[model samples]
Target: MLENKVALVTGAGRGIGREMALMMAAHGAKVVVNDPGVSLEGKDETDGPANEVVRDIKAAGGDAVADYGSVSDSASAKAMVTRAMDTFGKIDVVVNNAGILRDVIFHKMTDEDWDSVIKVHLYGSYYVSRAAAEHFRKQESGTFVHMTSTSGLVGNPGQANYSAAKMGIIGLSKSLALDMAKFNVRSNCISPFAWSRMIGSIPNTPDQEERLKSLRMLTPDKIAPVAVFLASDDSKEVNGQIFAVRGNEVFLMSQPRPLRSVHRSEGWTPETLRDHMLPTLKPSFIPLHMSRDVFSWTPV
Candidate 1:
């Protein structure tokens, strides 16, 4: 479906990013597999994953090349997009999947932890998307798939930094969607819950691992098809939206809820809030929960 398209997938060296890169290539995209090849904590590495993915794609009769650039840096991000353009003539799709984890409670979170996570997930997306948007604007047709996480939606304990960065992508994607629509460019965010190295390494016992696997609703491979759909022309009308993708499941995320309140003519007091407003507040009112469902191939 992506025939003749050139795609740049950040962090495509391993996990979901790697799978997405391979899938895009199999679908006829000339892919630029960009990855710093770091560990789950965003440290340590080898270029093996990115190189292996490229080799696998080539063996499968698909075209792809490896890029060992850190998407967190503006210069490197620009070079990644340029590599796609130089190698394949033009870039048609960008999957901003590069990220790092700095899981910690708010009170315990360090400045370094907060900065690093934001740098890779939020600023990294900004750097690469900004560069790609320029090329897409000129072409008047392009696709951007931002990698968000369920932590950003439901909020996981001890992941304040991670959640903040992930949720920021949603806002960024929505604003970009509105801005890029005039050029026929589409931008969307996906909050994925899948088993990957990051999840696997999360300190679990053998029994715990088995139990968690059974309960998992998504796998890395399942997430790729949605990415492919978003990157293809099929999703032309699907812009300014966020989706939660899991195994055979796809659902739209709801917007933030606005608070409704009653105003008093005179100055409010603590007693008034306790006696009147407290009772008036609806405890049964459920906050918006994003939709989740199994998805099949259909036009946007």
Candidate 2:
């Protein structure tokens, strides 16, 4: 599906990113596998992960190159795109899959904890996308597949930083789709429910044991097909959208839309809002629930 295309997949060292890179290559995409080998908390960088994935792709008769650059830095992020163009002559697709976890309760979260996660997930996504925009505009075609999360789409505790970043990515993807549609540039997001090093870092309790067991069944490879589909011409009609991929289930997630509303034609004060508007809107209020609470069923 991706013959003669060039794709840049960040965090392609392992897990979901690695799966997407390999799968894209198998489908005839020349892949730029970008990974700095950072730990779950975004430290301890190494080049081994990126190099290994490149070797694996080459061994399978697929073309690929390693890029050991931090996506959080503007120059480094741009370098990844530059590498793709320099090596393959052009970049047709970009997958913003690089991320790190600094899981902490909102009350106890430190500046560094919040900033690090935001830097890697949100800023990293923006920097890379902006760099590629110029080329995509000139070429008149490109695709972006961003890795979002249910934690952001629904809700999750002890992940203020991560959740905020992921939600920001969704907004970024939507705006990109709207702003660049004239140039035939497309952007979409994937909320993946998979077990990886990032998932393993989440705070676990006795209550989550069964849920964790179910999560273990959702391997990262299951999410790759969605990425491949979004990157190829098959998804040309898909943009500014979000899809959630579970074990064997693929869900088209809904975006923000008004469920209910109450208005006072006379423009009443706070008293009217508290008595009339509250009652009218209360019936349509969304429940305060975590991501797991909303997806309570076992993985299919």
Candidate 3:
């Protein structure tokens, strides 16, 4: 589906990003595999991961190039897109799959924790998309596949930074879809339930061992095909959409919508809201549930 196209996949060193890069290349997309091999918390950078992926692609008769650029930096992000153009002459798809985890409860979260996660996930997505936007506009065609998370879409504990960034990506993807539709550019988000290094970082408790086994079933490779479809003309009509990919289940997730509303002719006073609106809206109130709570069933 991606013959002759050029794809830029950030964080292609490993996990989901690596799978996306490989799958896109297998389908004939010249891939710019961008990865500044960093530890899960964004430390200890190396070029080994990116280089290895490039070698694997080449060995498999697929075109690919390694880009050891940190997505957290605006200049580096832009340079990655520029590298695609320089190497392949054009960039058709951008999978903003680069990310880092800084899990801490909201009260204990430090400035660095918040800033680092936001910069890489939210700001990184923006910078790369902005760089590609100019080219997409000039050429009048492009596709963006942003990696989001159920933690953001629903809720999660000790991930204020991650959840906020992922949710912000949803808004970003929606805005890009609306703004770039005229230029034939499409933007969509994927909330993957994949067991990756990121997921491996989560502290596993003896109580949650069984749940961990279920999570392991949802591998990163399962996410690649959905991203490929979103990036291809096959999904030309799919934009501003959110997809949650579990083991064998693909879900079109719900966006925010009014479940119930209450009004008063006199307008709502604090007391009136407390007494009337509270009672009327109580049944419709969404529960303060974590991602696991909502996804209680074993993925298949």
Candidate 1's TM-score: 0.89
Candidate order (TM-score): 2, 3, 1
Q: Write the per-residue lDDT of candidate 2 for residues 141-163, one digit (tens) a residue.
A: 99999999989999999999999
* Per-residue C-alpha lDDT of model 3 across residues 27-117, encoded as one tens digit per residue: 9999999999999999976889999999999999999999998888889999999999999999999999999999988999999999999
- Clashing pairs for model 1 are none
Report how far residue 20 has shifted in candidate 3, in Å: 0.5
After superposition, candidate 3 runs with Cα above 4 Å error: none
Model 2: pairs clashing at backbone N, Cα or C within 3 Å: none
Q: For candidate 1, give the lDDT of residue 228.
A: 96
lDDT of candidate 1 over 64-159, digit per residue (tens): 989999888899999999998888899999999998887766898899999999999999999999999999999899999999877777666677
Q: Compared to the true structure, candidate 2 yields what TM-score?
A: 0.99
**C-alpha root-mean-square deviation, candidate 3:** 0.8
Angstrom error at residue 67, model 3: 0.4
Sort the predicted structures by lDDT, highest score first.
Answer: 2, 3, 1
The lDDT for every candidate, in the order shown, is: 0.85, 0.95, 0.94
Worst 10 residues of 2 by lDDT: 260-269
